[model samples]
Target: MRLKVIIPVVLISLSAGVLAFTKLGLSDDPPGRYEVIMNLVGQMLKEGHYQPKPIDDAFSKEAFNKYLRSLDVEKKFFLKSDIDRLAPLSTHIDDELKGAQLDCFRNINTIIKQRVAEASAIYPAILSQPFDFTKEESVVLDVDKVEFPADSVARYEAWRKMLKYRTLEKLTDLQETRDKSREDSVKNKTDQQLEAEARDKVKKVYDRYFERIKNRQDDNDRFSLYVNAITTTMDPHTDYFPPDEKRQFEEQMAGKFFGIGAGLKEEDGKIKVLSIITGSPSWKEGHLKVNDVIQKVAQGDKEAVDITGYPVEDAVKLIRGNKGTTVKLTVKSVDGTVKVISIVRDEIIQEETFAKSAVINGTHKIGYIYLPEFYSDFNDRNGARCAADVAKEVAKLKAEKVEGIILDLRFNGGGSLPEVVEMAGLFIPEGPVVQVRSRGGDAIVLRDRDKSVQYDGPLAIMVNEYSASASEILAAAMQDYKRAVIIGSQQTFGKGTVQRLFSLDDFYPVKDGQSLGALKLTQQKFYRANGGSTQLKGVSSDIVLPDPYYEVSERKDSDALAWDEIPKSNYEIWSNPVNTDNLKKNSEKRMANSAAFKLLNENLATLKKLEKQESYSLNLATYKAEQKVNTAALKRYDAVNDKVKELNITSMKVDLDKIGSDTTKIARNKDWLKARTKDIYLDEAVNVMNDLIAQTLPKMQRKQQ
Candidate 1:
């Protein structure tokens, strides 16, 4: 388990001298905008949400608890007395929302501001000197499981233990480095020197982190978080996006946005270009490379503004511009070379986000299609559609005459519902794919009117815990029809509800040029053609594989909607349904005998043990011994990626032609092919396709006889 560092508010400053608590403004009068938004939100939730719960005392309390948890999940800031003081507002939120009175929010926000100011003074005092790592005490990593402090003294004590634990970790890391160096040469630094250096490293990390928090957060940001807390209480997917956030959301959904298209991240107080999106201005110019530190930005031909110490978010504002606009970036390459690169911003379409297929050269030629999401262009009817792209991939694979096809939806979190319907129609004959039920309405069966089968060969849908929404719809449809062998996790992410994005401005007219946020409301819930809702209980796989990495499921979310059933739609099952029992038995027998799977199980057991051991000893020797044991256990699973049995993945001719003149595109495609060679999941998926081919071959022979 990774121990999370809790940065006290006093740690907001770099040095001890700057730890001053400022008084917060706590006005009882609510802002007029708050009243307007509150009334709008209340009306929207009642009319727009799929299943609107009454805005009663129970809902208010739930929202109140959720808001506090969102603000401080680790129980770090507020004291027990503070919570008791605000306890009355837990049930009063119901009345407040109805009356457009934000007294609760005002009170809570004011108290948090005061708490943050007070916390700014504790950390600098604590980190002024070295901590005793030899102290025979333990620190809990899962602080959420613990209770809040009773008073200010208790809170300070909690912060002390947290800082000490972090300092100990840094100390251990430095000591290990010093020990490793001692193996080759004589060590110069003593334990005290190493401890001091370790403390400095921890302090710098927290300093940078706090600096960003201070620089980015404002009253409006706090208000946005407060609004989101209320919206998300309805469901995890429901959210309130402010004006700027709404624009970002639209850009994400559009798949193409007007910008320089360089992915940026902050590292060591510098904004570094992580990657350049292919087909973007930065990629075409061929100057900005990954790991290049951006120092300054100039819009058009204006004087360059120094962005050296700017946060990644702030640095992005300088880089992004209107389409066809020129932006100059002064960057420092990894080799210590400084150069100014000019790039004209344009529409950057993420091709990799679309559908792509490859031929897996093995015992059985398998067509592998990896759809990252069910992307669809809502802005243009003729724009990119995942369903159409998938159909194209199927055609490309068919041209190669592959024996089997594997649709990988392992990490696909789903997108357009209509695209999923069309994609599902590609496998089986046209029929009802899924049923959607709106609030206070009957289930409407969404069917594929197209009767033409695209690729009717042996198919296997690869899914995991993250394969959700549209992914689940497709998987559930295929499973219902016995069209494909669903393999991977026990069940997919159980997100069955559909959300409609609504602009807040449309609901209430604002003449003051003030910006109102957008709301993502759950308007409908989808059910399988078999009548079973895929809400809390997602689509289960036929051959459940070991997923030791991510323990994600709908049940983990406390506010998830309950699973239920509607009337089963009248639909015909596939004429030749899959023999799932035989397939499951064979897969299970093979898994029980496989070395890789045995190691995977061992790794899962180790992880489970680590999850249970949340407390860590402050003693250096004890901590090192525990880490050593965990590291040794992890070594067994190191060969998991190396044991990839020949998956000869090759790009299609169309893709090869597209990448012919572009070196970056060629390199990216080559990397994609190389990555597939080491994919353990893909290896198993190919094996599953092989099993399906083998099973179908005997049946074909009998049919001939």
Candidate 2:
């Protein structure tokens, strides 16, 4: 992985909440907080040759207050009052910093600097920590530890062992397969004989251990832990790219970098192919299929190396280099035969995260708006604002005389908080949209100062397991104000915390007067009006739907912050004549009859069964028997593909090879992407609105008569 070097700037007062200070007292000229801040700024400008605006006392105080408010655990997570208390040292530091005392300022700066060093030094150690499986049996640890949960630690170690064993097993199986192929070819085998012999040999090779650990609980636990560890460091956005497989993460976030235009992921100790880009080299090759496990990766002229325990980032670095380079991956087919395939790297651009609108057929035309993320170019003033773009989409829909709107925030992981608040304002009359409480119990209610509702009609917000941060805030507000009906999966990804990145390089003069350092810190917590923090316990939906996440896992399932409540503020609910109960009933009836819905339920059942297996034997005979069962299941699944195709659904195009190879679950995420595109949930939501119109319109007609 190529690390980008960023010049650090000294930590000077940058916002309203940060305290400022001058020289310590007792001198003829006692330096004030502002003067102290100015000195730091001057040093950064002179030493680092970096220019930054000087923050006034007001801005510093506000920013500081915001950061403090985020640390109030009781306010964010639903911890008991006693848990809300900060360590005495932290409290003292907060008080001193807020007071802007020069001595205190220096003390706080020293602590912050120490933390930066600790974080940087610990980063590498974190990656190398040996996984210990026994720790998973312990029950004393809290489920919400952001760093390492004992169960996860144990699970990760177990997974590492199992993966290593699986790698060796695969190599043995491959050698056997090659030997059989060579023997059959030399035994007067015709072309047809050779092909049949090869296929059978591969099938037998894979069938050996296919079912041995298929869908094991430990497998799932380990994969989830690995993903969490990589994501725990850096800002929430920076992820570790594993070496050999998984394509979904890259395609969905970074657009594209290099290697085959395929998404990959490790699920249950097997490499699962996700998706193949439409025009990528992989798509053209047609050799790689979704769900294929990547057994090994090799550079040009190097012996294939098993990358079972390699970190995702290291794997990605090796796979992705300058475009046009060829990388070889040894992939295990679903039937269990291995083949070495080569792919050329290319760029995959994301053109999907754009404003898309649709008009739903209803008594009152319903406007549909999907905002993927709050993306913007920080360097450009006129860069796109997802919120602003969404507002415009709503306006356009209103112009078309639509009576209601559905804002799809299904997989939106959140970007900018301000944008969400602004977007919420576009729907309701001016009022408090959210409340923010700092460490000192200081509460600031953010309101929509603008009184006009951009398009008040009827509103519904759609979300799922992936909706987080700002998405949670928006959903909570809509739920609080009764502005919209929240619908979808059990709950969203519970991540309500806020973070800020600090450049450590600016803290002190370069040690040798040379390099710079940087750090990202978790600073604040976001709360919903009515005093409920959306931290670990995400906002619940008014109406629930059958989603895979509901049965398998949820935001709260991971090591997450707890849920808590605070004092409620006076807020008014929106007045609407629609009958919510009736809407729910109608949706329930529709879902019961949908074929797609039934299929989803069946798949969920199988997934649950797979998630429960705990132990597996290393015996070869047992492994081979397990492989046969898995082969049968795959064949059954393939048989159903014909049915899926017959449905003629645009989203039902299943290319097993592509889906199997994608590690990011992007291909299987079809269920999610399909839910977003041909949104059955949205379809149900629209029906609810139509029913509302039907009931209300008749009553209005009667009144008029």
TM-score of each: 0.89, 0.53
| 555-658: candidate 1 lDDT, tens digit per residue | 78877788999998877777556788878888888878877787778888888888898788988888889989988888877866655565689987877986
**lDDT tens digits, residue span 21-109, model 2:** 22222234534423332343323222231112233344344333333323321122112322232223233322332333433233333
Runs in model 1 deviating more than 4 A are: 1-31, 182-186, 277-279, 283-292, 295-344, 510-514, 644-646, 700-705
Candidate 1's error at 183, in angstroms? 9.4
Query: Relative to the unseen true structure, what is the C-alpha lDDT of residue 548 in candidate 1, on a scale of 0 to 100?
Result: 71
Clashing pairs in 1: 9-120, 10-119, 10-120, 10-121
